[model samples]
Target: MKENYTILAASHISGVPTESIRAWERRYKALTPQRLQNGRRSYSTEDIEKLSLLNKLTHEGHSIGQIASLSTKNLKNLYQKHSPQRHPLAEDLIKHLHDFDMEKISEIIEESKLTLETRSFVLDFAAPILSEVGILVENEKMTIAQEHIISSILRSHFGTLLQISANLKPQKRFIFTTPEGDFHEFGILLCAALCLSRRIGIHYLGPNLPAHELIMATKMLSPKAIILSVARLPKDLQKVDIPTYLKEVRTHTSASIPIFVGGDGYRPRSSADKGIQFLPTLAEFDKMLENFTK
Candidate 1:
């Protein structure tokens, strides 16, 4: 089944702003959405692909006036011209996905590990390929099963990498997890692998962790910090209440322990929630680790 997403979700998936989507609809007739009886715009995966293409082209110097009406295929052809090197490794991984060649996927991942340094492997190559797989799945170019296969294989790769350095004494420690509503584990796993690369110990508690359980673990482990990852936000406008969940988690933990929240779905908000800091990307996370250790 083709996936249908809300405008907000589309904004996140396509890297387009909600305001821009509305403007494009009203002004440029970029792409029409299916409207509900209540007047909410439901964006299809195809709509997301169009918006994503538009967003990529605009970023690469194309004007909306010139390309907003173009088909998704045409926009993609133009985008490749602009971002010729967007993700060189991404294409091969995606191709392997389409072919159901898990062995070749593992070969590419392992080769990346041996050729690139840990940070480059994780940030530059691994991250981009996984993100592209996510896009392919989101845009319906790949099956959900294919996405899971890629993720599971990569997860094993990361596990081996993390284990090799287990004997190294860590300079800092953190507990990485997601709340009960967020089921994505790859984000935190990647985060853990990155931290491990820097000799930063991470007590990673996979996903769907309850707040009370997290609070209990915090008390038991007394980690230097907590890193909560949220990979998806609620699509309903009325349900975008993740801040409340952030606050609830904060309430159960110590004010002195810095809690960081991040992932694709995180929205920018005031860091007024005591001890809750948002690190939106791995680069920012590296800076955070550097600053914390300093």
Candidate 2:
């Protein structure tokens, strides 16, 4: 038997804006709420659950357009698969790291199976988890060795995927790297993995690459895009002329090639930069890629 829920009731249950629900129905044919003889739209319980999951995914930085196309079953599958391993492991790993329990840490690492389970783990899982691990180190909850252990496992995991992806398509190459003095490359590696999943051609430059070298590499390879991952700007470097350096690189490259900046350091300072696009997270970056491909 179908259970009926009014628009307001459904909105309350699903946490979706009523207007958004209306728009989804009108634009995407996403949710076809039944019409009563009196002309009010009424949603079923199944509809409510689907809309709830859709709201969760949208809040997680997925596009409404993409979510609209997924079946209820697919949505459930995605949620079930990714929700369990989101950020808790990194937090727990840090706690374990503080205790210096090598045996337990080894057990945790083995249980986490970061390398073994990486293929099935989505980008949403990996990026936040890594970020959490970084925070643990930054907060001194874990020693550098513990962080390195987890990072080494992830590096090997992503490195294997990168190798496999490298063998695929040869079209539209991109070179990804971290800017000068920015040592964080986990985001860059995750981006590489995402590109791999899509079979997009990419050459990863790893971390701590100078701008001049990046420009020179750009001139040599002529990649479709140059992605710079800047996790944090050192205090000394913050005062350095970012615009001047960007302009310097621009002089040597075609104006059409897009330069995308990602990670924490690239967070918006002002709306002044016309040439650079700041991508805050891997999910946001992936959406940009999706739109570009479409």
Using Cα atoms with residue i matched to residue i, what is each candidate's TM-score against the true structure?
0.69, 0.61
Report how far residue 208 has shifted in candidate 1, in Å. Answer: 1.2
Clash number for every model? 0, 0
lDDT of 2 by residue, 13-129 (tens): 577999999998898888888899999998876787789788878777778887797888678556644554454554465566677766776666566654534433545345655
- The per-residue C-alpha lDDT of model 2 at residue 271 equals 34
Which residue pairs in candidate 1 collide?
A: none
Error of 2 at 49 (Å): 33
**Model 1 misplacement above 4 A:** 1-87, 233-241, 270-274
The root-mean-square deviation over C-alpha atoms between each candidate and the true structure, in angstroms, is 6.3, 12.6
